[model samples]
Target chain A: MSNPVSERGFEPARHAELALLLEVAGTPKPGNVDRRRDLSGLCFEHFLTGAVGSAAGLRLAEDGAPVGEAFETAVAGMSKQGGGNTQFGCLLLLVPLVKAAVAGDLSPEGATRAAEATTVDDAVSFYRAFEHVDVAVGDPPGDASDLDVRRGSEAESALRAEGLTLSDIMELSAERDANAREWTGGFARTFRAAESILNDEGPVTDRVARAFIDLLTEEPDTLVVTNHGEDVARDVMDRAASVSDLDEAETLAEEFVAEGINPGTTADIVCAATFVALERGVPL
Target chain B: MSNPVSERGFEPARHAELALLLEVAGTPKPGNVDRRRDLSGLCFEHFLTGAVGSAAGLRLAEDGAPVGEAFETAVAGMSKQGGGNTQFGCLLLLVPLVKAAVAGDLSPEGATRAAEATTVDDAVSFYRAFEHVDVAVGDPPGDASDLDVRRGSEAESALRAEGLTLSDIMELSAERDANAREWTGGFARTFRAAESILNDEGPVTDRVARAFIDLLTEEPDTLVVTNHGEDVARDVMDRAASVSDLDEAETLAEEFVAEGINPGTTADIVCAATFVALERGVPL
Candidate 1:
């Protein structure tokens, strides 16, 4: 927990948990389950539970375990805590980032290399990760074979028969999933957001809220699209883009919450961005 | 960290940090640094830093190190993070409790035995803990020799000459310092709060906030007394006692913040209570 004095080097697990906690504690994060508000089924405490639940397994990625195994373990631990997917996308983004950090490289290039190295076993474990909670992923591309997420082990078998690595599956879903796009496209937006967060002119929470707004504005949240529709998601992004004041954002937040238009994917990206900022030793 | 699979047992360090985070994240925690507000000199980020800074030493106490040594190390680490005393009283309460938990004892009697086991070295180290932060404490009893906290090492030397254990020093300050009172009185209120938290039928944050208000109502907050005087402290207590509604509490919180009446001692007790609850397998 303290700075390592021995050969063990930096602890990525602590950094990951701290980043997740910071992201959740960031107030006025519109449409997300932030410190200021908690939705009925998905309370802020669930995220806290998920953060603690994931810590040990995320640390295991540093020990050369497959990222997918860590992801599955973390997801299982989180499910045991409660009956919801409070941070599924955040976990997905963090697993590889944690592995890359353990390898002493945390840049987009580093994350890309880590994601590119995923194996079939990692793909199988990734499928296993979906068994516990109802993670919101869009329908697979029409060309994909037997890619239904609910068919957990069956999907793993199909993925294995197709000789698809986890990275390959991510590439397939990249067109729809922002998290997958981050994985396949070398986390470009996440890295940029990280840079901005490091240089932001405020408290860590304020910086995180700003970063979240920026991310939300830049992309239509896939979760919103899945739950609502493309038009609604695009409208959310547009509203996010127009916000220059936090108070205005807060007003919009109430509207979004009432309409059930959570920009959850963007919140996930902010969590990753926070991880990068923290890993780079931002004073926050 | 994960639960014990072999001989290592549960991790107290993670629980401690989680408790601290939950305490800070609990919204509208009147006159304290909760998610909705940050004091001018002490921002929320400083508390975050202090939590991270204190983790390693608290873990060391769980490894059977002397509570005083852990307290000094934690305070020194926190001082290095910034020039503030974020959780000094909580640390004073937690070090002994963590030690007791490591011994498989976390009740009031257990904490009492643990505190009663302190040595003069522990007393000296406790004095040294003061060197790092300007924690709030009242003037010493007129009869006690060389007992000033501002004297630092000189006071430590005087304490050594007097052959006082850390618990003996705590006993001397118990009348004025609520945290010291907890140590001397075997953490009775903390243990009671823990029981309340365990039996409470809601989210952990809600329980914590309720427990905090209850504590504030019962005790006139020695920290507030030190800053504003006894009448103001009693008035604050009566106001806290009248809060049957959280929204009303929030309004009062604004007034308390404007008046600069921080109930820090109650916050410390809440932290200890949180530790006890977590240790006893509270769902949080």
Candidate 2:
């Protein structure tokens, strides 16, 4: 297939993949995997493998593959490495961004438009992706238990019967899932964090770390809320807000890692923001 | 352009780029950048940037762009990051291997055939790449002073007059440059190291570290020979040979970093070997 994206000499898929790498490599990410640390079940190498493995799927998106097929392909490839859900939310954010980029724009509006255009097949594929890895998600609302992501492919019938587009499904979860919020809310937090990253000084990794901390401070991470309670998630954000510098952030990183307090949703936002910053020509 | 390599469901370019990332991420590589340490002038993030930056050029090679053009383009793109020559020699080896992989065969013979098929124009582009970064090299032999790489594009006319292909230029420096030796010797060391990496147990990063130590022990690094003397290179090999485990390797890593004794040529070979290993299905 002729790739308009490639023809324009812009590699959105590569930029998205690099964003995943840079986000993971950014140190002192406060309980997230980085160059210097790994969680109990995940290592730094797993992130590397996930970033690399996701390339084929990302390229498929760049080549104008259907959003659902591209996302499912990417999730499958990403899960090939043993790091169960290394970049699921990150890819959730990136796949649509890539599709938007392929369509000749990568703005927040462009991404939202792309997300809005996703078909019921896209919803099916997104659900199928959950089968590849164990993603920590809150309980589906009372009215949508049949559409629980944990049901994976089993939710396809319900999704198709209701004629719910991928964006529609995301809207259903927008009240709780930070990643789904980006789909429904035009990626406001992601784009804001991208600006923060572009404006920061020093190395790109440091910039990402700073952005991650800022993001965590600004919002209670949904993943943390699901794993812990709202009170604990609020406490986590309060602690993040107090991190004044990288040294302080490093200390908090140790504490959070020890406590198993991974702000994974915020980290996913950082990954998406990183892609935006890179696409905007933030120097490597 | 239609990419036959991508059409075949293979992504040699991404594999090569990941090889660069994995090589740099492998811990305690004695004298090279890794997850645990960085050289004074080059940080870990710089390698990450270099790996990401080289993607476009790698894609060019995968799309069947001329070997020389692709190599030069990759070098240029890799140099976009501030780390200066982070993966120059690695790219030299990778460009042809990627080309070979794109052609449906990634064997040593295929790589050699790709290398040997280069024309005088390829030689010009290869020298042009030297202009983009400060690669360490010994003095050219007396007979080929006019074609010295340091002369960069200035030696284009001389290369053309002498009818020297990129492989022919490599043959001249093969005795002094371990990377060039791979080009002349059909990547024997690279393939052998790939075997070692694949056969070794534990994480892929650990396997890479093991292969790196083994390679450093087996041969005096050519970059060390250029920066230090042949005697110092031999001493480095001896020191590497004495490293019985990762702990000892870590100790040596501190010493090498402190003393500015980077065995870069060996690291380049390790990167190339990593690509081969990944291609051969060494699980991430």
Candidate 3:
């Protein structure tokens, strides 16, 4: 038991170190553009509770809701099997799954219990039911130094399933998405490069990251199109138009990592670059 | 104005379309290894903020603190520039960047007023700001829409001053590393991953989105060791011993993506595989 997997211990220090190296190599946000998982725990807390109570909650747009009712329209749309998220969305309705993971077996009592336990606490409790199951925790992120920010695979799947179904059950999913793209809409992205020149080629800042997220938001059919658009732009336009102050900041960040400098000094320089970009009001 | 940028009509519809797609695509919680950017508005915030404060609010990890106080220890070990994240951590700071077209050259007071607005309000304010600067309200996005995400090469060449002195900036210029092969702390990752598997991951019900976020939490260095180690094991260990069920999920995910599923769905399916792997608690 004491031994690491037969493969033995993996050096996580490598991530920080590579981050350090990337800092040194050129302070870019690194080639890997990370897409984060559902981190809006606060809303989720509310949504989960609503899911248990009313069996759903509104999925809002950056602007607000769409014209009509949230739930009825969506359930009708997703279940038709001809929609954009055909197989994926409807999977949530499988009563068997909810029974096994959420409510545990076919019974109105089970469904009621699931509904009752809809908040994060309920989700966590529901998650506890699977401890004996022989599933991997996905990427195996073994860091919980911080309670909220630590995890890998496992329970997320169940939660996602629960989330999907409840969302469908309520139908806020469609209404919430009332405003997608139209970056300048409610959700605008403002990116900056870290180099001396001002352009778009650089790390993923709020702007760049938002743009990326937006382009890929929903529509399974457009995945490749959005991805290719982003890739092409990153390759050609990034260097030509990245926000340079960002580039400079990255350069500084790289040096700090290579030298193993303290975190504070590094933060200041990064903040300053961001402030400059903020001052400029990065275009949406 | 009939222009889409104007809120009364044109722009809102475009946002609706984008939202429709994302709702359909499904940002399902993936099952495998992933990390969560646990902060409220790290990226892809459902709402909007003005350029200044928005950019300043972002923190890399939940634990991040300002440099002067939190990084005192690093300061001693490093130069005026030395501190763990002195230069680096600052770069991770997120800033709010309003587009020049949105709100240009406002006094700090004007900027602040605009900043106070919500996403929709901000967009409206920003669109008005464009008039102050030499800009057009350009047509709304459509099949032939051309709202450019690109900027001119020399947008800010005028902003730089000679001999800028940064106290603790991170340096990203290339250089040799002390260790021939980079390494770092891995025990923590090992423990976390193990604990997660024990805690989450189960059969038939794993989610995708949340798990991937958790997986991203481990220091990338740990990933190289664990994953690259598996890669290493494949070369040296029994061929069959190295392959994993997680691989199956990954393959499934790739196939899904190839079929033009949303990246979020690909992430979901792939993450599920990872969760399954962790739940099973195989290959360290």
Candidate 4:
């Protein structure tokens, strides 16, 4: 009999969606929502619903839709279940990655190329997606206040007048947003983490968790920096660096959830890494 | 701005896939795998992977593929991750439900019509799926040995000679398999359970878990009956009937997982009900 995986063929859209699901399903990922724990406002089920809801946008990306349109659609679909912005940053990373995967190259260079090709319309779409969910973002630098995501569609005119492509906007935010940095820097961290995930042993979820801890240890999470300042973010990273195994991670997970310290950006990067790994033939 | 949900439109394929995800994510559902628990050899991540892998087949059903073909394809894809039959029975119910939903009627009657329309080729496909996963099935009756599912594709000639459509085969197994009975009985139990799920308040996952306990209280689970016999199945029902709230159910969940008593058939029915509820507008 023919191999069923080959018979079904490679589905970049499904892989992207599965990446979102698997990212949240990984247990003891420290601070973020996972299978075993939930934050006060966010639960595991919201992530599940968001992953399913995002399918349409993922399909659009695979079909070669504009990055901004796919990202906005994914955000809107993800917010449809009212989980309150479960995977916005993850979707930002995935849309281009999926498009690149569909174009027969799923490398970081391919993803960066896809992101670089986005137009001003894509920027408008990306901004409009802000209306769908209450995403927590740091205040825009004074010079870019007119293009703040919190301004939603109100920023569209400024975006158009500035002729800022989604990639251009991402470049502007690269220093503050880990997700945006991937767009500008060829997704280096995402690719590196994907390699780690592929090289790790045990169930894919466990591998994802280990990779997540490694990533958290490597850098202060941007979301934590946004919410709790650099000091707290550095402290969180130090705690992450101390976790050598799942049991220690589980203890940290409980403390993080209890203290309301969520390292969301690191989780988003893990989601992106998961897509890359799956595209590179990570089983399950 | 256009309503994003309307902009994306109704996606029965996605709804079916989400049902599979939601079914497994609902916590404390007695004995089966859920967000917080897993039976021996079947971790929660396996179900997550299985749900993602089954998307291609769910899409096939929505696109009007034959019931048996879609089901077998789903089973093949689900087994791709080596979950060892994480969702074989759930897929059996979802394939027809998705087909029905795609046809503009997601009611039990519509599901029945879809199931009844399956061809002999679908039966051959159904038998062939057995080669993919080691499903736990009771021994076939002495007279039906030639059509045994354990025989896999080797029984195709017998199925073709007998001119057995997938629905006809389901009819023969209806008395033994709750999943088969849905095909023969217009999915009465599935619809009733869906109504219960929709009526319950709180998180959709909590609703699913409560509805699961309700369903288990109403009848002895067919898989439990197959594995542990009628007496044990009845005892399970009694225990389920005593669960008045989530806390009680949590206690039972721990006990059930420890004892290795998985009420898989009830879980399958709940999965089917989840699809129906989602189609009928269950939020998240």
Docking class of 4: acceptable
Error of 3 at B107 (Å): 47
Tens-digit per-residue lDDT, A1-284, candidate 4: 23233232248898898899889988888888888787776888789888988988999998888988998989888986655779999999999999899888788788888988999999999999988888899999988789888889999999999999999999999999988999999999999999999998877889999999999998889999999999999999899988889999999998998888999999999999999998888865
Better of 1 and 3 by TM-score: 1
lDDT of 3 by residue, A90-160 (tens): 11222111222222232334323333333443333223322211111112223522121122124455445
Query: Which residue ranges in model 4 land beyond 4 Å of their true spot?
Result: A1-10, B1-10
- DockQ comparisons of all candidates to the true complex: 0.23, 0.31, 0.02, 0.41
| Overall local distance difference test of candidate 3 | 0.23
Candidate 3 chain A worst ten-residue window by lDDT:
A1-10
Of 2 and 4, the candidate ahead on TM-score is 4
Give the DockQ (C-alpha) for candidate 4: 0.41
Top TM-score prediction, candidate number: 4
Give the Cα error of residue A91 in candidate 2, in Å: 1.2
TM-score per candidate: 0.90, 0.91, 0.20, 0.93
Off by over 4 Å in 1: A1-11, A142-147, A153-156, B1-11, B76-83, B141-147, B151-160
Query: Candidate 1, residues B104-188: lDDT per residue as tens digits?
Result: 8777888999999999999888987787777777777678658787666678778878899999988888888899999989899
